[model samples]
Target: MTRALLLVDIQLDYFPGGAFPLAEPEAAAVAARTVLDSFRESGELVVHIFHVATAPDATFFVPETPGIGFHPAVAPLDGETTLEKHQPNSFIDTGLETVLREAGVTELVIVGMMSSMCIDSTTRAAHELGFVCTVVSDACAAPDLTLGETTVPGASVHAAFMAALDGSFATVTPSASLV
Candidate 1:
């Protein structure tokens, strides 16, 4: 089956000194770069999904902001496909499914920021769309979240989301396994 690497929301907003920094952003970016380099060397299809927040009150990834740009580590090459999305699911109104189908991509390797949100939504959507998905856990990061009076750790949130995706929506693996 044909395979493609889908890098989602690997933008500056998730890195340190950006609008919404996540836990271990540098480490995740490095891991993502490893897989991205592997794909490039192998001449495999690579698509980048960038979240462009349209909500006026959105704090990060606002249009025309520097944070909306891709992180250097996982930036898309000139000829690579780039999809700008406004929702958690990359396929939602982004024509991602059509692009994957046109490219004959039956399998996807997903890695990116905000594992609990974008990763979760995209993986589930891809599964429902009949594409086999593999999520690289180490190449994804999540920020801490607050639920009512409780604060959840970023690492724990990431792990929980990975666990939820594994064996169901997608196969959760580390970058080493793919690289």
Candidate 2:
């Protein structure tokens, strides 16, 4: 089956010192770079997705901000396609489905930042859209979140989301296993 590496929102805003930093962003980026290298060497399709927040009240990822740009480690090469997204689901109005269909991609290997948000959204959407998905657990990270009186740790949030997505939406694996 044809496979594509969907690098979702591996951007500056999610990295250290950016607008919205995630836990262990550097480590996730390093793992993603390794998977990216494998995909490139295997001659598989690679698509980079970046989120651009258009809401007026948004604090990060506003258009023209450096934080919206891809991180240096996982930056798209000249021939790779880059998709700009306005929502958590990368395929929403992004022509991502069309691109993947045209490339004959049946399986997607997804890895990126904000595991509880973009990664979760994209994986579920892809599964509902009929594409087989595999998410690299160690190659994605999320920041701690507060709900009501409980403050959840980033690592816990990341693990919970990965587990949630594993069976139904996608197969959760590690970067080393894929590489």
Candidate 3:
């Protein structure tokens, strides 16, 4: 079966010095780039999924702002497919499924930002859509802001999300071994 790497929302707005920078953004991007480069060498499909905010004047991820662009470290090549979405789930209101189907992708190896939100949503959706999913743990990161004042730690939140997805929605693995 053919497999593809579905990188989600690795944009400027999600990195250090951006609007919603996550903890350990640089590490996550590096890990993702390493994994993607290896996959590209192997001739696997690499689709970069980016979120374009549908706001009028929002600086962070607005189409007009540079913050909406993909992060420099994880920039996709000319041959790679770029899927843009407004929702957290890449497949939602996007042609992601069609693109994957056209490329004969029966499985997906997912990696990217916001492990608890976009990562989680896409992983579960892809699994339900009948693709075998593998989530690159180190290549994904998240910040805990669910609880208002008594906020949880980002690392703890990332771990919990991975644990929840490990055996059910997807197989959680490190980027190093996957390539």
Candidate 4:
């Protein structure tokens, strides 16, 4: 099957010194970079999804801000496909499916930040849309989540989402095997 590397929101806003920095984002980016390098070497399709918030008083990923720019580790080259999305699901109104279909991409190698959100959302959407998906676990991160009086650490949150996505939505594996 044809494959494409789908990097979702690997931006500065999720890293150190930016808004809503995640736990171990540098590690995640480095892992994603390894996978990206492999894809580049193989001359495979690569898609970078950037989140640009349009709502007023948005906290992160706002338009015209450096925080919205891609992190250096996973930044796109001249020939790579770049897409700006407002929602967690990269395919939602981003023409990601159309692009993939046109390129004859049937399988996706997914990576990037906020595992509990974009990574989970996009992977589920991709599976439902009939694309075979493989999510790189170590190449994704998550912010700590809270529910009323309880708080969950980012590592736990990430593991929980990956567990939920594995086997059914997509095969969840680490970047080392992928690279």
Candidate 5:
């Protein structure tokens, strides 16, 4: 089966000094770069997914802003496939499925930011679409989350989401093991 590498929302907005920086996003990007390089070396399919918020009330990832640009560490190289999306699920109106199907990609190696959001959503969607997904856990970041009176640290949020996704949705792994 053909496999592809999917880098989701590793954009400027998630890094330090950006709109909504996540916890240790740089580390995640570095690890993702490792996997990206591996895919490039193998001449495998690599798709870079960017989230561009077009809503009038959107706060981050606004259109035509540097915040929406892909981070340098995992930026798509020349000739690599790049797709933009308006929602957390990368497949929604993004032509990602069509692209994958055309490329005969049956498996996905996913790495990105916000483990609790886009990463979770995309992995679930990919799994349901019958693609074998392998998430690079260390190559995905998560922001601090708070609801009601409780606030969860990003590390805890990341670990919890990774735990939830393992086996059920995707095979959660690390960059080192992958490459």
Candidate 6:
């Protein structure tokens, strides 16, 4: 099966010191970089989904902001393609579907930020659009924990999001076991 890794919103804005930082997003970012590098070594496809806030009165992810660009360490190579998105779902206002269709991508290995939002949205959308999705458990995150200090970690949020999508939307797996 033709597989493509759908890297969603690994931008600087979501990093720990950025404008809208996620909780421990750096961990997922590192894992995603490793996954992308592996895909490059194995001659696989890596599609980057970059979220650009196009709203006139934007609060977060504004393109002009320093945070809008991708994190320094997770740069895309020449062969990799970038899809700019205005909405949470990468396929929402972008050519993600078209690009995937053109590449004949049957199965998607998904990873990136905001596990409960954009990540979850696109995973389900891919399934509805007939592409099998495998969400990288350790390569996604959510900003808010369950409650307080005893709340769940962002990684757990990642796993829960994956589990919630089971059977109906997609399957979930760890980045190390993906290949």
> Model 4, which residues run further than 4 Å from truth?
none
Tens digits of per-residue lDDT for model 6, 1-179: 89999889888888877887777888888788888888888887889888888778887898778887887667887768988888888888688888889988899989888898999999988998999988887778787576655777666776778789866788877788875
Between candidates 2 and 6, name the one with more favorable lDDT.
2
**TM per candidate:** 0.98, 0.98, 0.95, 0.99, 0.98, 0.90
For model 6, which pairs clash? none
lDDT of 2: 0.95
What is the TM-score (0 to 1) of candidate 3? 0.95
Candidate 4 C-alpha lDDT tens digits along 70-127: 9999999998999999999999999999999999999999999889999999999999
RMSD of 5: 0.6
Q: For residues 1-179, could you state the per-residue lDDT of candidate 1 as single tens digits?
A: 99999999999989889999999999999999999999999999999999999999999999998999999988888999999999999999998999999999999999998999999999999999999999999999999999999999999999999999999889999999888
CA lDDT scores, all candidates in order: 0.95, 0.95, 0.90, 0.96, 0.96, 0.83
Candidate 3: which stretches are off by over 4 Å? 56-59
Pairs that collide, model 4: none
User: What is candidate 6's CA lDDT for residue 164?
Assistant: 96
Better-scoring candidate (lDDT), 1 or 6: 1
TM-score: model 4 vs. ground truth: 0.99
Query: Which residue pairs come into collision in candidate 3?
Result: none
lDDT of 3 by residue, 1-179 (tens): 99999889999988877888887878989999998888888999999999888877665687767788898888989988998898888999889999999988999999998999999999999999999999999999997566666888788889999999999999999987887
Q: How much lDDT does candidate 5 score?
A: 0.96
Model 1 residue runs over 4 Å out of place are: none
